[model samples]
Each structure stands twice: as structure tokens, then as C-alpha cells.
Target chain A: MADTSETAAAPRTHVSLQVNGTTREVDIEPRRTLLSVLRDDLSLTGAKPGCEMGNCGACTVLLDGEAVYSCLTLAVECTGREITTIEGLSASGELDPVQQAFIAHDALQCGFCTPGQILAMKALFATNPHPDDETIERAMSGNICRCGAYPKILAAARALAGTQAAQQ
Target chain B: MNTFEHVTVTDGNEAVKLLSERGGAAGETKIIAGGTDLLTLMNASLIAPQRLVNLKAARALRYLRFAEDGALHIGALATLADLERDAGVARRLPILVESVRDAATPQLRAMATVAGNLLQRPRCWYFRGAPHCWLKGGAECFARDGENKYHAIFGASSCVAVHPSDLAPALLALDAELLINGPSGVRTLPLAAFFHEPTNDARIEHTLAPDEVITEIRVPGQPEGANGAYLKMMDRQAWAFALASAAAQLSVEDGVIQQARIVLGGVATVPWRATQAEDALTGQQLTPELARTAAEAALAGAAPLAHNGYKVPLARELVRRAILRAGSVPHP
Candidate 1:
């Protein structure tokens, strides 16, 4: 067992992470969450930490194109996995369709949960290009907006769903 | 969360060996799969392990498939999302899928493993937030006398907190078995035998040894004409734990129930098997009245706490609805 006695200094292991099409290396303790590493180390503050536990979806991010709560993910476990944050959503300086819809639909009040919400919808569209209302609601249920922007968020998602379906 | 050394194990045998060698005590060396529940517990200061054995690298254990005998075998690392999206599971054992469909959230389902979900601890406010709860090795159970609207209504000795897993009751009703790897090698345990109410002596909810690593969950083939359903009553439409839930599986032939398995969740310290309810339904005709009788029998012995009396009737109603749905009988 690794020594966890009071006097023992915490061990830090080196980990390589593939974040937003880039390879980043960091030496950190094993307990550091992916959210903390993203915000504190990598300076990607888009993913907020609402609840350090998995209850709030403020820290939602895409891991291998699947939505997951970064607060619940360990930095070390993310090795070799593709991670996409809100900052990475539009790396080409062009707003993604989901982000564009969020703006076009006015889907924000305080905008605290918008990043997580956008990432969640991005993951949904990645898996299912054109989801129904029930699918959209179920997929976005994890991201809570205390400002009651759910109706607007739904409108944005619906607009995107229509566009994607028409294009397909 | 306190900093801890993390080691990744590629297989269950290596995990067991590491636990046996490095695990100083029963709860010191923790095994982390998905880290959905364990990380939360650690963040709450409920448990501070010295080392976490990351099982995410145990790629071999991440599987869901059916055996030739029509039995379902789910690997320990199979996420709840895997079960939710599995068409085979939906066709064969839909109750399992139903139980996991609205459990927590999509992100949680994506990260929570089958074994991790079954092994998660209670969600009682007192046990989770209070520092002096009995389940946390403190003197008293505050939920027994304090606010306990979501507490257990049955089989709570020292801890009135209910089991929080939605999948547990469904799996218990299906009579699943667990394959565990320990220092002595692998052993299979009936799912029913894996859980127990917390007592003064053990104060734990499960029978898994410190060195044991759950490798697979084996659900036996159901008899012909068998069907099952899981019904949960939550405080909200979604993203909430069950206040009371019931899972019922029945094998009926020619409108006569040949066998039944009834289990209740979020109502006891363990996944409660409603044996009396099962007995009431066995050899009986599928009818709304019979379902009500079984539901009544299921909660006949329930001893509700000061503030959780509503759970009795609520659970009874869920049991009734679950039975009706499983037997495909019209509600009267």
C-alpha cells in the first residue's frame, strides 16, 4: 500500500491527456479531477464546477465523444481518451450549430450552465443527429439551469434538430 | 477529496492480488470503477482510502452478452448506459433496462458501472451530510428520529437509510449471481445472499470482502411466459432517487401465475425480497385484486419510522402496479 501516513508527502504521477485535438502533459496527484485540471491547469474555464459531486452538470464534457461529468472523472483515467471542452467546440473560430442555435434562440440568462449544456447537446448530436423532443429532454436533464432557461434551451435544440434532419 | 495513490490494474486477478498485498485494512484500499460513486463518497469525507485501484483498465471485464443457455452475463465494468442501450437486454429483461433508464442522469449512467451501482451506499441526508450518523460509525441514527420522509420502511435495524440503487431490486427479482475474485480464487454468490441489513456488529450493507473483486453478474434464464417490470415513485419526473420502487417478475401460463419474484428498493437497508408477496402471487390468477393482495402482503411487516409512514402505502401501490405491469393485466 502506498504510504498515506500523515508525514508522507502525496505522490504525483505524470499523465498525458488528449484534450481537444492536442496532447498535454501534467504531473499531478491522483485525486485531481478532470474538471480541476481543465480549469486550474489548462486554463479552460468554460466547464464550471457547480457540484463537485456528479449531481450538477456544470462540469459536463465529452470523453471520446460521449457526455460525462468531468467532476466525476479522474485525470489519470483520461489518458488516451479524446476530451472536448466548450473551448474546443469551435476551435476553428466558427461557432458550431448548437452554439449558434443557443444564441439564435436566446438560451441563456446567467450563462453558468450554457457551456455544459452546449457540450451535452453536442454529444447528443454526435450520437443521434436528429433527436426527438423526448431524446433532447432526456439528454439534457443532467444539465440544470437554475435560471429556468429550459424552454429556450429546448427551442435551440429543436431548431438544431430540424436543421440536422433537413441536411440529412 | 484527499489525495491518494492510484494504480491501474488490467485484470481482476491483478486487482485481487494488489488488494491482498497492499490493502492494509478492509476499507483502506478502494477499487475504483467509473469513479461515479466512490469519488462522491471521497469528496464527502465519508471514506478516505490510501490507494485507489483503478479498474477502468480492466478492459476484459467491460462486456454484456448472453450465454448459450439464454442466461445474461454482464461484466462488472459494464456501465449502466451499456445496459440501457443494449437491445438484447431490452428484449429479454426489460425490467433491468427500465430500472436504469432514469437512474440519476445520462452522465451518471454513462459513468456508473453495474457493480458500482449495486455497491453504492445510501443517500439519506443525515448519513450523507451529518458527521455523527450510525452508518458512518457514529453513535445514533439521526434519520430514525429526525426528518426521514425518504428513509426506509422495512428491515432497518441500526440504519434506516434505504438502498439507493434502482437496478438492485430489478436484479434481485431476476435472481442474479455475482462472480467474485479473491485471494482464494473465484466464487459465485447469489445476488440475494450478497446484501444484508446493517447490524451493530458489521455495520456494513454488503458481504463483499475487502480483497474480493466482482468480475461478472450472471442472470439466469427466465422460464417461458416470464415477464418483469420495475416501477419507481420519485419526488420528481426525473433525476431523483426513488422514494419507493418495486420490481416484479412473474411467469404465468394460461392466465395462472406459476411463479413470482417481488423485490422492493429504496425502502430497506438492502434490496428487499418480498417473499410473502411472491407467495401471495404464486399459483394465483392474474387479476388486479390479486396484485393488490400481493402488494399488501409485501408491506405487511413494514415498520415505518417517525416520518416515513407514507412510504408504506406508496411502496405497496408501487408493488401493485409492478405486478400488474409484469403480468400484463389491465389495471382496474
Candidate 2:
């Protein structure tokens, strides 16, 4: 019983999406990506949309406490989910472990994909404090760095993993 | 660019209600979740749904559970991140995790829902190109004769875009079930039946009703003393679709195969369940020789397209390797 006509006379509805611990309600274009909502509506530009498609992980954000590509997600779809943008990585001005590690290891050259890469690394470190080479490779495969900063990124992650192990 | 109206639903029932109300002979209404697929279609102007319903608010539709009969019930909205994070899923259905782990980046996995993964549109260039091709309700699929390297080999007559969900084949191997809900009520179908080949339904990838929303995915629990494994062969090591892949589950008793499930991915239209492979392994001793023979049996009837001929051997080899690996692992 699908509508065969191209035009629907109904009006668009407004919705609230929990974004970076703050609820933002806005009117959005039906075709707008969640990336657009976060950056344009809420003005949280921490999550960058490098590739509009899900290919590059540059637009990665945490939806319901898990990392997901924001560019490929719709704002209206995330009405009730908790989101964690790169802005949430720090409480005040203090750097998160993953961020600190990236700084320590110098894990960036041009740094466009840094936010997404750090988030991926942070997620990996949280789950697996000590990841083998294969696991690291598999986990970080999606975030591409044109600057060839993979070795440094791995080093940063390894340093944090070491610290986490020592604390344990 | 064509613009469509957007709607968001809170649960499976609400999605059905929205669809029932919106999709009534005027035009198609789309249910978008992760937007991993829908955004591409919209950007490319391929599918112009008059109404778009977003299902990410459906919390009830995003759970992993064990039903009354020991079935591993996973809500369709369960994201790849959820699958990877769930200790129970990792302990029981490691292959599901392994398959989805390569679906995209960690970011995409967190956003991508299981049902959306199953229902994601095809990745064919023609489908996403500037011109309309056959798969988009046309008379011919452009991939049929042009740039069909990534197209289907088995169960493809008209449209040949390979079903891309990596977790799908693994689920089929373990005899997964999909629970769909719509205006007509609830419907339970096998994961194998969930997706149809081009001959069965050339217009769509799955048999889900226009108003149907995939609510739950149930994988029957593995029997006692059963081991499972999944292997994917791809172009590169990261975030790439499988060139060919296979998942195998086996129950071994005193070094002989007592029960087996063999499923192939990236080789057919749907999650290709290889009955021929299972038949070859039943009651056979668990050995490299036996595993290789069973793998060969799996691809015996495989019909390959022009550019994808190598997929036949690649898929078979993956099956052999996965079976051998699973068979060698001692069951608890």
C-alpha cells in the first residue's frame, strides 16, 4: 500500500537529539546528515565530515556511547540517543588519555582525520588494553591518514595501553 | 535534487504505523536508520521516497537477548559496535563480530544498525550513477554488461550487486531468524529467506514488506560441543568488502563431524548457505583432506560471471580454510 505519488502534503516535524550531553531541538532538512546537525545547528565542529560517505572515518562520533560515522547518519534518526563528539573528550581543559597519547606520540601531520583516529584508538584501548599487532591493524583499518601517521598513532595507542596495564 | 519529507519513529510498532499511514499507493516511503545506504541513494537521486522515516529512536528494536527456546535474539537495530561490545555475543557468536568488524570504520559500526545493515541498498556504480539503470525499477542492470567485476556470480539473472552485509552469511551458517513487524502484524522468517535472489524478486534485495520493519534477529544457539569460524578475503586489510568470504560451524565428536553449517558471503545474491558443503562434511572425520573436499563440494554448482570467475575458487578456498580452522578447534 505504498504511495505511488511523489508529493506528500504533510509538514516536517521538529525533533530533539541528545548531542554531546546537551539536548538540541531543531528544524532540519530531511536530507541533512547528523554531521550537519552537530556542526551547523549545535555549532559543535569537533566532528568533521571529510567524506560525506562512510568511507573515511573523519566524521566519526559516538552514538549511544559507541563510535559511528556521523556523516552517514541522519539527525532525525538520533532523536533519543546519547552522543559523544570530540568536544566531550575533555571535561574542562584537561586532555583525555587518548588525546594526550596522540600529542605525546606526535600522531598527526596535517591532522584532518585526527579526531576520528583518536576516537577509534580510544575505543580500542578501552576494550582491549593490550591489543596485538593484528588486532590493532584490524581495529584501526577504517580511519585513513593521507599523511602516513599510522606508526605514530599505533605508538600513542601502545603507550596508553602500557599505562593502562601498569595501572591494572 | 529531489527532496523528501522526513519522519522519525520511536519503536518497531511506530515505524509500521508510520509506513501504514504514509505509504498508501501515492509513492514509496523509506525507513532510514544509519543512513549508510539511504544517504547515498538520496544524494545520487536514485530513490525518491516521498516520505522518509527514521528508526534510530527505537530502543526496543535494538536489543540482544535469548528467547524461550535458547535462541540468540538480537534486535535489528543493534549496531556493529553493540555486537562487538556485547560480551555474550562475542563469547557465543564470534563470527558475527568478526564479519561486521570489517564492515566499515569503528565510527560507522557504532552508527550502523543490524537491520539497516541487512537492508542497506546495493553498492553498484550504476545504481549510484548519474543515469538510472535496471536495478532502479528499470529493464536492465547496467552492471550486467559494464564494470561487473564486483557483481554477483551465483543466483544472479538480472541485477548482480553482491549483498554486502558481512554478518549475514555468518548468521545464515548458524541458522539465524529474522522477526519482522508491520501493519499486518508479526512475521518470522529464516535469515536465508529474508533476502531473495533476483529471480525470486528482481525489484528488491529482501522480501520485507513495504511497511515491514525488521525488529529482531534470532540466531539459534550453537549446540553443545560446537565450534564456529568466519574468514573473509578482501583486497586490503582494512574497511573493505570481502572479495570472497565463508563461515563454518561444526560439531565434532571424537574427531568426526556430527553436525555442520556452511555459509558463503560475497559470492552470491543473498547470504549463500551451502547445503552441498554441509552434506559433504556430515559424519566425516575432521581433517584437512576432508575439509578441502567439503569446500570443493560447496562450489560445485557455482555459476560465475565473466569478471568474477576467480571468486569461485576464492570462496571455495575460504570455505576450506574456515572449515579446517573451525574443525581443529576443540569444543568445550
Candidate fnat values, all: 0.82, 0.76
- The ten-residue window of minimal lDDT in model 1 chain B covers B18-27
Best by TM-score: 1
Compose the digit string of candidate 1's lDDT tens values, residues B10-118: 9999889888875448778889998988988888888898889999999999999999999999999999999999999999999999999989999999999999988
What's model 2's overall lDDT?
0.78
DockQ of each: 0.56, 0.45
The first chain of model 2 has a TM-score of 0.85
Residue-pair clashes per candidate: 0, 13
Q: Residue by residue across A115-147, what tens digits does model 1's lDDT show? A: 999999999998897898899999999999999
Q: Against the correct fold, how does model 2 do in TM-score?
A: 0.88
lDDT of 2 by residue, B158-267 (tens): 77888888888888888888888978889999988888876634477788878788888888878777778889988887777888889998988887888999988887
Provide TM-scores for the models: 0.96, 0.88
RMSD of candidate 2 to true structure, Å: 4.5
